[model samples]
Target: MGGATSIKVEVYGYSFDNTDLVARQLQSGMLKDPAFTQVTLSRDEYTPEFQMNFDRTKLALNGLTSTTAATAFSAAMSGSVASYYREDGDEYKIRVRYAPEFRTSVEDLENILVTNAAGQQIRMKDLGEVVETLVPPTIERKDRERLITVTGIVAQGAALSDAVAAANKVISETQMPTGISTVIAGDYEDQQDMFSDLLVLIVLMIIL
Candidate 1:
């Protein structure tokens, strides 16, 4: 991470496989760096139906339906602009939604209303389920494999190269799980390129 007056070096590892094992190895390397401040490991998983079932059940129990429940929930989260009112040459939208406190919990969500064909108000819980959960973080796929990242933060005045080298050594000594490989990228690649160019320039100067 960098600030207004100086640049700080951070080393990050990108991996497609055996993320858990690599994370542990990276964690160990951070412990050895006096300049190390923290390390983070992250992975992504997908589950579309996890909490959806609860929403469906809640709607069913409340004498409402899924379509109605969905509409109510959406409106509750994002207010709808019914019309625009002009005042002093300026126009403002007339937005409608439940009060913030009213829609703060699962119970509040279940109580949301959806209008039916018969003009009856249906509760969200009547047609769907509502359960609190950690929705899996989004993932981008490359070659049909999940990606994981291990990030390390180095203390001020620490050389990025030293931190990266230490991280690489630790990773190499650790036994990686099958189907996993770690790669150094981002700023590390730029540093490598710069170093290579400098060495070539020095050699050329001597030859001349």
Candidate 2:
């Protein structure tokens, strides 16, 4: 089991791409710093997502909506469970989806078919295009601004305050993108909140 974490660091930015870069850099710097044993990115940076872009005018002409086209495209790529089969004492799901040849590339989406209001088959190509791009698997927002978290694990016998102070130094020395900001969160934030509450309780006890 992992030891109780002593602190957490959150590096914020205007966009995920910029924040991710900084988080990685911060993690590398933290490992090299004497104050921390390891600093790891809270989220993976290079998650690939398929984007299907459609022309609204074209869709309207074909009596199709973006929702309709997206639904059709998702069904084709991920497949739909249509039925089931029973074998021996186990039950199996039988699914229907596009063949590998049709689901292999972005161009394969062009072959997708969706029926319009007219009951006519409309090819995806007629609606728009598709592209593969990097997208964040999970989005984190603080004050409605995007941020990335880089968690720093203090070395055994090292003080948590030293790790936090070292991280703050790194943030100060590191150049950031315009409009980007950073804030400490995770375990560190929780620790601060708990201390504040405890201080209040102590002061109340003395007053009583």
Candidate 3:
């Protein structure tokens, strides 16, 4: 009923893997069916990211907390307000951070200094690891829940009702995990709403 494609299926869940798994299953089933073609999942590609996984035990032993370590890492990567300069009754912020050349590579990130509560300077590498990972390039949400879409093209001879029935069959055969749900949206949903409204009008006319 929303601004969805003519043949679109939406899956909603909190876990990325679970959502992807369900989407893939539906896409595969659609491809196998003769009614649908050009089936694809929305999240076909991922973006590379550098993720810092911290060790809480190590941090605790060094009299440091996760917050302290995270603050240091953020300051090094993103400049922080070091001081304020005032001139001519106007104030300016003096931000200090590592130079581009000093923070280009993972090695450089590991070398950034972190001072613990005990006044000990520790290497960032000792407390955590920087791993390269892939994440969804774009995240979509509906009603505050994460959503993924599966789109397909209807075959020339196939009716929209047939395509919807195929999709429903796949959904029925699949076991959805907890906290996950699916909806058949797009043109079919719109058609259903139109039919319901027409039925109501016909009933009112008969009563009158």
Residues 100-170, candidate 2: write the lDDT tens digits: 88877777878899998889999888998888887766777667867777888787777778888888888
Better of 1 and 3 by lDDT: 3
Computed on alpha carbons, the lDDT of every model, listed in order, comes to 0.62, 0.81, 0.85
Superposition error at 15 for model 2 (Å) = 2.2
Candidates 1 and 3 compared: the better one by TM-score is 3
The pairs that clash in candidate 2 are: none
Badly placed stretches (over 4 Å) of model 3 are 1-5, 43-48, 51-68, 81-106, 115-121, 131-139
Steric clash count of candidate 1 = 17
Candidate 2 Cα errors over 4 Å, as ranges: 55-71, 79-95, 114-123, 141-146, 185-208
Kindly give the number of clashing pairs for every candidate: 17, 0, 0
Candidate 2 similarity to native, TM-score? 0.69
Q: Write one digit per residue (lDDT tens) for candidate 1, span 1-208.
A: 4641111222222443345456666677666766456666555453432133435555455566666556667777678788999999999999898898987778887787777666778765666576766554565445565656566676667777666776777677767666666666545667678999999999999999
Provide the global lDDT of candidate 2 against the true structure. 0.81
Candidate 3: C-alpha lDDT: 0.85
Ranking by lDDT: 3, 2, 1
lDDT of 3 by residue, 3-114 (tens): 3245789999989989999999999988999988678777767776656678998888888888888888888888899999999999999998999897777888888888
Please give the range of 10 consecutive residues that has the lowest summed lDDT in model 1. Answer: 4-13
- What ranking of all candidate models by TM-score puts the best one first? 3, 2, 1
